[model samples]
Target: MFPYRPMRGLDEGLYCVDGSFGRSPLGRRMTVLVLPSGRLAVHSAIRMEQADMAALDRLGPVGAIIVPNTLHKADAPWYAGRYPDATVLAPRKAVARLARRMRIDGTLEDDWPAELAAALDRLALGGVRMPEAAFCHRATRTLILTDLVFNLGVQFAGLSRLLLKLDDAYGRFGPTRLFRWVVLRNKAALLASLRELEQWDYDRIVMSHGDIVETGGKQLMRGAFASLGL
Candidate 1:
């Protein structure tokens, strides 16, 4: 079995899977941010469910659950109504895309405080305008991302296995150069964003469809951007 450690402030803790192909979805460790009051801000919600509500009950309640992005929107809503005061946080653009495919009533973009923006700027993890996106658990040095970069295959199934063979996301780790050129809209700004994010010194990463990088997360991001000629 892979190794896992309970991150004190983060309940339900973090786990990691290691293998030749790197960690797959099944072994990704999500960092759970449990506030003193008992509210929790879980990174990705695959393992979360209605039945698990009782365990989370110890905390006052669940507040502001985040889907992080459209790529990982599938499992978020199952538990939304369970919490009296929680709404899924999704990129404004993704809200429509995901809603069309699922029954989700998520919140639009949130206005972050200037202090938060400045802090990110100081760390070089400045703002990114990727249709609809947000930074999470600033204190954790964590960045929640969607399709801007896919660390794993999309629709990993029978036919998809073959189709993904040539698709940029398959067998590929991190963002492909062509995908970035085609989807980034403006390369100059994206490069600037990467540079800013590099300054933040983040050590962990949470992606919608792949594994969680416990350490060396910043290097993975830096390496991916470097491949794009940034």
Candidate 2:
């Protein structure tokens, strides 16, 4: 079975499951948001054991499954199959790409549920070739992201460690050199989006890959982008 940790609470009404990307040492995380209505919205899904699925079910019915970005669609099909009734959402620019793998009910830019809208603020990251999106959970003051930045740290070893270090993401909470050179197409557009994001009141960050930033997220995010002269 694909290895994954059971659901664990993080903040009020928020939880996460730790997993990995295929055989890679790069860690992946699935964030679960429980709306005030008790419905659940899953972000960047990971295939989990039956018991863990059961645990998720016990929390609430899965009302929405978010793909977040084009590259993060690996296990979205699995989640779509398991929660057939759940609306599958992806970034507007990613709908076509994600549709090649699974059914996409709507785009994150539009068609978001009222319950989800009430809990989180969503934004599409512009000037990036990868079609990524980011969210801020207002109640928990947490920012949710996928691939815009990485925080791999020193948890990895050997090749994985060396590669991450070379990428400039091994021991830092910032974007990799490759991400800046290739994935980032227009610094100005991304900078505008980041400026808007700065207005959000978030202290913690929950990203799909690597460890979550428990505090000082706003500062770290600003610093990450500032390095790009954005």
Candidate 3:
């Protein structure tokens, strides 16, 4: 396993959860996101240890587990069970497919769903895979994301990490052109997700990777996506 050092991220009112990333059983890692309410969201949840669970409990109990997009299975049941009360919520369209592969049945909720309704502003980033949504919670001006975009660090392994410096994104936060160019399938949907993300009101961006964007984040994200012609 890689050293589990996490981002000691933004101290803003929004409790940004830190998820360590390494290789996944599926060949890519799945980063976990912890919500202020103590909820957990990740790609797959199998065998997530109790120590991590206890650490997250400090932020809040896992009210819900979000499987951001359909591609990853990190938020699986084995992981969800770590929190006795948390239920897994996935996108409406991906529910059945996820259920079949994981043997874990989850309830699909729209956008931030009803539970998160009070806290998030739902903007439709249509055409990108699912009806991608970018959210803004007024309490913290924090925007939560789902593959809608990426910003990797300069410290990761392989030649890809070195090239990341081209974006002027050195070992901290900001967009990773390499990661984006490789992962984004259907540029049309990616573009839509970007356009919608720009309209959101937020100063902090809580990503599933790298460092969190702290200030002028909205502008940073705008420039990040706009460069792709999204």
Candidate 4:
């Protein structure tokens, strides 16, 4: 299992841990951010061994567990089992899917603790067939997204390349056309949300499935949405 480690040159409070999606071979990432109270909020959890758990403990207590991606819930139950007191938050639509396995403390729309609330804001991508929540850190000027935009630029090889191309995602830096076709129900509403996101002052982007954007994230995001003609 990959261990938790601080992301280089990012804000001191932010960290990332890598894991493979179950049986999928592709690497996935989990975002861990330390709140002002020193507690941690984890997004897209992955199973960790004892040593990694200890490492996380050294960082801070696990205070919040967020299942941001509609389909990325493999480790949520494991995290909830390990940190029973941590608040479990997921998108409204995801609640039903996850309720089959674990208890949900709240949906993204609910009020979070003051410490985290002060630093984070959740944006729900409305009018999409699959519900997803995007988060922003006010202090770091960072945006956290899941499946909205991908930066898997030139990483896959051989069969993976062909499959990604078939998936409409090979080496691309934006949402796959197939994904949009399947989930984007109201382009206007999605466009409005993207435009609102453009208004944010984020310079970095941390996405679950791709390389993080280190700078000019706003422009990158704007260009991405514009590419869809939204």
For each candidate in turn, give its C-alpha RMSD to the true structure in angstroms: 6.8, 1.2, 4.9, 2.1
In candidate 1, what are the lDDT values of residues 1-230, reduced to their tens digit? 23333332321322221212133432343434554344555544544433344554554455555555554544466656565466455555566776775544444335332333432212112234345353544556666554556577354766656555555666555764445555567666677767666666567776544555557877777777785455
lDDT of 1 at 43: 46
C-alpha lDDT values of all predictions: 0.50, 0.88, 0.54, 0.81
How many clashes (backbone N, Cα, C below 3 Å) per candidate? 6, 0, 14, 0
lDDT of 2 by residue, 1-230 (tens): 46787789999999999886778777788999998888999999888877788998999999999999887778889999988989999999999978987999999898988878999899999889989999999999999998988887787888988888888888888888888989999988998889878999999999877789999998899788875564
Candidate achieving higher lDDT, 1 or 4: 4
Candidates 2 and 3 compared: the better one by lDDT is: 2
Error of 1 at 103 (Å): 10
lDDT of 4 at 81: 87
Writing each residue's lDDT as its tens digit, candidate 3 over 145-210 gives 655445555455555555445644456444445445555566776677667667767887766555
lDDT of 1: 0.50
Put down candidate 4 lDDT per residue, 1-230, tens digits, no spaces: 44434333367688887667655534678888999888999999877777767887888899999998568787888899889989999988778888888878888876566767877888888768888988898788899998887788777788888877887777767887766788889888898888777777789999887788888888777777885564
Query: How well does model 3 score by local distance difference test?
Result: 0.54
lDDT (C-alpha) at residue 115 in model 4: 68
Give the candidate number with the greatest lDDT.
2
User: Which of the predicted structures, 1 or 4, would earn the higher TM-score when compared with the native?
Assistant: 4
TM-score for each prediction? Answer: 0.63, 0.96, 0.67, 0.92
lDDT accuracy of residue 94 in candidate 1: 60
